[model samples]
Target: MSRLVVVSNRVSLPDEHGSPPPGGMAIALSAALQRRHGLWMGWSGKVKAGEDPSGPISRREARGISYALTDLSQTDLDDYYYGFANRVLWPVFHCRVDLAEYSEARMSGYQRVNRLFAKLLQPLISDDDVIWVHDYHLIPLAKELRNLGCGNKIGFFLHIPWPAADILFTVPHYDDLLRGLSCYDLVGFHTDDDLSNFAECLRRQGLPDPITNGVCQAYGRVFRCGVFPIGIDTAEFERLAEQAARSETLQEPSQRIPGCKVAIGVDRLDYSKGIEKRIVAFDRFLRSNDHRIGKTQLLQITPKSRTEIPAYLAMQKDVAERVGRVDGELGTIDWMPVHYINRSVGPSELAGLYRMARVGLVTPLRDGMNLVAKEYVAAQDPQNPGVLVLSRFAGAARELGGAILVNPYDPEAMARAIEEALDMQLDERIDRWRAMIGRLREYNVYRWCDDFLLGLDQR
Candidate 1:
């Protein structure tokens, strides 16, 4: 087997700073690197002047993983990550044209950072190593690698929604960006919608005309682009859920449930998550469908993220007000229609909460792949499983077809879906849950990594 070289804007692996091994994306890749020896390259999230390491830099080691991180100055961080990638490209990719800040300064920073990745990466490359780049922060990286004469199978995966061509055009220099992307051996997206956007971008840019029109294409330039929807480590998540049940963090909530059927909503505190809308729906559900208010409970655990960004702060305030309104209107001492928590709990504690929930309400307005849905499925009891009420717009909805899909924008519809999901026949619920769980367990993160590498090998 060939060696693997994993690169991303931020290394997901653990460091001396005491961050837990990231539960999903980072942990999955770390497992792959451990199973098959390789080099993981990314930023150390630090800045120091004039001390650049120019080799296969190794930053730390733990549990069969060699963690490597390079330093970036404030200028590099501002231009590449904060300015271009997040402010410019990220918003455009995610269909937030209204927020995209396109300027030469940001674009220049984008290219400079990508070039830096390539320069640092050049020393690490060997004849047999397959280069795998992750997320939108490094779309131009493969092109940079190619410029450095790296012909090894290089793969890049985008972890955000790929906007429609009409929307993607909102970016100033998309033509150059798409062309740079085409240099990879394989490009991966989380859903058909995303792959469709990328393919349309290819056609619009006048890439070679030997094209079959569709949501996905077998080749981009000399590379293949695809939809490899990532999945959770089912067994690991199940274990986490079980452990969480015993965790002290969950003890209060578990005791408070008082045997009512729990509806779980776990998401990051992001505007696109439709968190506020979900609160309104929960309130409506309590108001109109009074019969279940005492029998059913809603627990929304949204861990805070991007707290420094203005948009994020606004979202937090919005969520807080909506949550308070729901509780104030519907609470009767023993039952609160909405319970909003802004924090992160370890995996074991999370798993316990997941297992207790009868209806997993995962209604993100748009998401690359909502791992919480997958985690909920993985945590359900095989004998008496739970229902997943997911959003039709979420990328995971494409793969988890058995979930009771709802239009997130419609509060009434989502509320009704919640009712239906709660009242679902046990045998049918078990059947759907079993099928979803089987799919999840089979296409776990290890398999996702393996499939991308296999495709890269073909290059």
Candidate 2:
């Protein structure tokens, strides 16, 4: 078997205790690397001035897998990561063209970082190594490696939505990004809509249509594009939920809100998450079902991210204000309608909370897969599972058809969905949960990893 090389914006190295990183994607990728005795390389999540960006890679070995990390300079972090990748690609890909801040300097910095990554990585690559690059931050990596005369079979996976040509064209030098994708042996997206949108981008650029057979001819090379909806480590999460249900910690939250039903929403504090919209819907739900006012509570757990960005900071304030308004408008002395926690919850505690909730609200304005939806389903009780009120825009909505889908933009519809979920019967909940859990059991994160690698190998 050929050696595997995995690269991404940030590396998830195991801690000193040898415990693997959190999150299903990290665990799945780490497992895959171990199986192939692979090399995993990425930025070290450190920034310092005067240190060489292309300095000798920091190397480590753990559990039969080699890990390589490189630190970025402050300028590289600002222009490449914060500037182009977050401000430009993230917004444009999420169909927020108005938010994309494009600049020639940022674009140049993005390209320069990719080149630096390639320069640092090329010497470590074996001739037979199969390279797998992850996310928008590293889209130009394969192109840079090819420029450096490396021909290893490289694959790229976009973990976010791929916007249509009109939306993508909002960025300057969009052609460069498309051409960079063409350098890959395989390009993967989270959903058919994303894959189709990518194909349309190619067609609008006068390239041959790739939709017919998933083969594209562009920039004097041919590559394949396909959909690979990501999944979670369902069984592990299920076990966590089970353990949490039995633990004393679950009693603490339940005791605080005695005789009340909980609806949980967990997400990173990002604009695309629709946290404010969800809060509005929850408020509406409370108003419509006045009898259940004091009996129903929404526990929204959101952890802050990318605090340096102005848009994110503004959104954080907006969401906080919205939460406060909802609580003040609907709360009595003994009951608050919305309990907003702006911090991360540990995996065990999160699973317990999911299990405790009577409804799981995962309404994202736009999301690649929204693994929180899957995790919510996985953490449910089989006998009397909680209802999942999901957003139709999420890629997970396609697979988790058992969820009560609602448009995130429509507060009324979402409020109705929430009511329906709360009023759902035991038998119906079991059947719906069965429909989703069966699919999850069959196509877990490990299976997703295998399918993509198999596709890359075949290519």
Candidate 3:
């Protein structure tokens, strides 16, 4: 078997001594690495002074998996990661062009980092290795590898939305990015919508059209592209929920509120998450229907992300004020309408809360795939499951059609959907949940990884 080489911006090194790994890509990629005797390579998540970006990779071995890590300088973190990747690419991909800050220095830094990665990775490559690059941070990496005379079949996957041609064209050097993307043997997106957007962007630039079979000829190269929506480890999440239900952590919420029905939202503190909109919808639900004010509660646990970024800092304040206003207007001495938690909780505790909640509000303005929606579904009680109020813009909404879909931009619509979810009958909830679970069981994270790898290996 050819070694599978996985590269990303940040590698999540698993804990030693046989403890279970973290969730999402960490767990999925670790399984793949162990199976294929692969090497995981990326930044070490440490900022050091005067460290060479293209220096020799420091290696660590854990649980039969080898990790090749390199440290980044503070300037690289600021210009490449914070400036180009987060400030420019992230917002543009999510269709928030207003937040994108494009500059020549930022683009140069991004290119320098890609060049550095390729230089460091060149010596690690064997003739039979197949490389897989992940996310927006490394779109140009495959091209850089090719420039270094590496012949391995390299695939790239984008884990975010792809904006339309006009929105995408707003970024400087958009053509260069597209040309870099064409260098990959295969490119993957989370949904057909994103794939179509990519195709349309190429067309608007007078590039050749992509066929229905997912082949496109651009920049004098032919590449395959496909949709591979990500999924959670459903079985693992279910087991965690079962264990969490019997733990003391769940007892805290019950003891605090006794019998209040809970609605939950878990996301990072980001402008694109529509956190404030969700809170306003919940507030609307409380104001319009006064009968359910004390009967229900909303617990939004958002761990802060990218706090150094101005947009994130502003969003945190905006969400906090919204939560405060809702509580002030609707709080009784015994009950508060919203419990906004800014810190992250343990996975087991989160599972317990998911099990406890009557409705899971995963209403993001835009997302690649909202894993929390699937996690909520997986954590629900089999006999009496909670309803999932999902945003139509989320990639998961395409697959989890059984969820109560709402437009995140419309607070009234979201409030109505939340009310519907809350008022849904048990039998209907079970039917919806069973349908979603059936899909999840058939197409979990293992399947996604396998499918992408299989596609990458094909001619």
Candidate 4:
């Protein structure tokens, strides 16, 4: 078997006691790495004040897999990570063209960092290793590696939405980014729509289309692009939910909001998440029916993210204020309409909450694949499953057909959908849950990992 080399923007390392990372993707990738006796390489999530960004790499090992990490200087973090990756790539990919702040320095920094990564990683690559690069932050890594005379079969998977040609054209040197992707042997997206959008971008630029059996010719290079919808560890999450449902931790939270059917929303505090709009819809739901005010509760669990970015900082404040405004108006002395939590919650507790809720609200404005939607489906009680009110714009909407899909931009429609979820019959809920869970069980995170790697290997 060939060794697998996984590279992402940040590496998820195990704890001091040698416990694996928390996320399903982390667990699945680590298992694959262990199976191949492979290497996982990326930024260490550390920054030295004035050190060279191309400094020595840090090496560690656990569970038969080698972990390689490198520290970046503060300037590298600011420009490459905070500047181009977040400010330019994130918003544009999410279809928020107005918010994309582009600059020559940021673009140069992004390229410089990719080159630095290639330089540090070039020596470590064995001839037989299959390289897998991840996310928007490292789009140019394959190109950089090829420039360094590495001939490994490299693949890239984008963990975010790929917008239309018009949206992508707003970015400077967009063609250059496309050429960077051409360097990879294979490119993967979350949904067919995203893949089509990528193909459209290529078509508009007069490059060969990937729509013809997923193969494309661009920049004098041949590559394959395909849809690989990511999934969670469904069985493991289901077990966690089952255990958590029986615990006292679930009981305490239920007692606080007596006689109210719970509707839950979990997201990182990002503008693309539509946290504000979701709150508005919840508020609209409350106002549209006076009798339902004390009868229902919306539990919004949003942890802060990307605080360094100006847009994210502003969104954090906006979401908080919107939550407070809704609570103040609709919340009575006995019951608050919206329970807004600004910090992170443990996975076990989250699973318990998902099980407890009557409705799972996952209404992101734009997303790669909202795993919370899947997690909610997996964590549900099979006998009496909760209805998932999902966003049509989310990539998960393609797979989770049983969800009550609504446009995130339309609060009225979302409010109506939430009402429908709350009022859905037990038989119908079970049917919907069954439709989603069956797909999830068969095509899980491990399956996704194998599929992507298999594609790369075939190429």
Candidate 5:
């Protein structure tokens, strides 16, 4: 078996045993590296002045996995990361074309950084290694690697939605990006809808469709594509939740209002998360059910991200104003209808919060796969599970069909779904939870990694 070479935009350094991993990519890739003794490589999230683009990569080892990291020059960090990747690709991929920012400098910087990655990474890789690149930031990496004469079986996985051809073409140098994808031996998406959109994009360009068996021919090269929906380590999550449930820190928040049931939403402070819409819907829910104003509270924990970005700054103001409006309209001397926290909470605390809540609200305008939904489900008590009110546009909705699905675009619909979730029967909650848990247990993160690797191997 070939050693797995995992590459992503950010690499999570291995931490202490029994501590929850930082991100889903961290958990999944760490497990793969531990099982196969592979190398993980990525940017070190550092920007240095006058740093050589071809400098030697930094190496570290911890928790049975090896890491190779490189720092970006300040200019590259600005143009490549904050500029093109986040401003352009992130918005376009998530179907937010209105927010997409384009410039020649950013495009050139993106290509330069990818070429730099290829140069630095080439020395560390062997011909027998299986290379797996992750996310929109590194879409052109496989092409750069192939240009350097590394013929390893490379795979690419996009963690966000892949836009239709019409939307994708809106990006500058779109042909180059598509051509870079053709360099990969395999490509993976989170859901069938994403996979279909990708294939349709290719078809629009006169390329062959990705077959059910995951093989396609484009740019005179064979490419394999498949839906590899990511999952969590269910047993591990449950253990964390159990440990959290025992903590007083986790108990105090829910006990803030005696008899009040908590409905929770955890998301990054981003527009695509539908944070504003969620607030509006919660307000509408309160308006219609005046009797439940003090009886129920919507707790939205949205940690700030990319604060330097203009759009994110504006959204922060928007979310704050809306939360204030709702609270002003529905608050009493002793009780507030909504509790909005703009800071991050640790996993253990989050698990505790998840267990304490009576309803889990995951209503993203559009998402690849919102892992919060899965984590929420895993934290629920089997005897009295919390209902999941999910967005139909989320990739997780495809598998989590048992959830109370709603269109996030419509506040009234979302409000109705929240009401339905709140009024759901215990037996129905258990049945829905059991169905979701069955899928979670059957298709754990380990299994997703295995299946993708297996697909790449057979190709």
Candidate 6:
């Protein structure tokens, strides 16, 4: 069995020994790691310093996979994580061009952390181990690994949108970023547009130019670029939904939205999500069509995210005001145009929510690949599936064409798309669901891992 080493920003703290398993982004990657029960590496989320952070501090086994974690001090958490990674790269990568905060100190800290990660894992890494890294937080990890004279198959996948080269140019150090990415044997993005944007950046940064099929040969290594849109575990999500549908939580809502079609939108409360804009679009949707008052209900589940950031704080206030104003204008005592719910939901309940919805509204201004959109398709009823109103800006839009594509920035357009989805026929809805599911089932997470690994092997 070939060992697979997985790295991420943080590891979930296991509670009881018999828990199902820690399965998030990294754990999903652990399926590939299961053949060898390879090590999963990441920060333990505990603040510390002056200690040997180079070695694994803990270990656990679950679902035929093993996890290892280490602690990072307050300084590292500030500079390496909150300061550099989140405060800078996260906003920039998500296309908030104006909100980027460039700091030389943060950049240096970012580099140090990558080097630390590489140093800690280097000894544990065997020749047969494949290192699969995830997210923007670890972009320079492979470079650090390579710099230490460690040669192994390293593959990277970005879970967030890769901004257009023009937007990326806002950073003072765009060149350095791509230079780090070039170290990976295989680099994966969520869609062709993201790959194009990245490849465009590589060209501008004087990095090795990708040939005909987005292949770039440089540093005595063949870099294979690919667009592998991420997906949820469909069978598992469906099962959870089925179980949730029978729960009292879902039953309460069944009676709550009486005699009206429900449109559902679930997203983290973040600036990039455009939650305020979504509410405004829903307001337009209600104002334009008065008959919809008692006929249509918009269910928005916005769980708070990055609450500590000032920009995010302002966005939350803006969304609240927008939602309130819309309700004040269009909502009657018997019918509220928007049923807004703020806070996180377990996956089990999201499945039920998807089933009850008439439309899955995922219109992020820019998203790498919104898993919610794909999860919605997975939880649909083939006999009478709900419509997916997706943003053209999301990476999933490239593969899930059956979705009712809309530009989220355009309020009027989004409003019309919502109305159209609610009024769609069963056959058309089924056709669209089938097409979307075809792509989803075919290019699932399993296939995504396989494709990325194969590309890495060739390099």
**Poorly placed runs, candidate 2 (over 4 Å):** 51-54
Candidate 4: residue 183 Cα off by (Å): 0.5
Report each candidate's C-alpha RMSD, comma-separated, in the order given: 3.1, 1.1, 1.3, 1.0, 1.6, 2.3
Query: 195 in model 4: Cα distance from truth in Å?
Result: 0.8
Cα lDDT tens digits, model 1, 6-83, are: 998888766675343757667778777776687888887777565352223556776666667888877777777788
lDDT at position 421, candidate 6: 93
Model 3 TM-score is: 0.98
Q: What tens digits encode model 3's per-residue C-alpha lDDT throughout 67-90?
A: 999988888888899999999999
Backbone clashes in model 4: 0
Against the unseen true structure, what C-alpha lDDT does each candidate score? 0.80, 0.92, 0.90, 0.92, 0.88, 0.81
Which residue pairs clash in candidate 3?
none
Alpha carbon lDDT of residue 248, candidate 4?
94
Task: Assess candidate 6 and give its TM-score to the true structure.
Answer: 0.93
Question: So what's the TM-score on candidate 4?
Answer: 0.99
Q: What is the TM-score of each candidate against the true structure?
A: 0.91, 0.98, 0.98, 0.99, 0.97, 0.93
Which candidate would rank higher by TM-score, 3 or 4?
4
Off by over 4 Å in 3: 18-20, 50-54
Model 6's number of clashes is 0
**Superior candidate under TM-score, 2 versus 3:** 2
Query: How many residue pairs clash in each candidate at the backbone level?
Result: 4, 0, 0, 0, 0, 0
Spell out the clash pairs found in candidate 1. 241-351, 244-348, 244-349, 245-352
lDDT of 3: 0.90
Residue pairs in collision within model 5: none
Residue 404 in model 6: shift from native, Å? Answer: 0.6
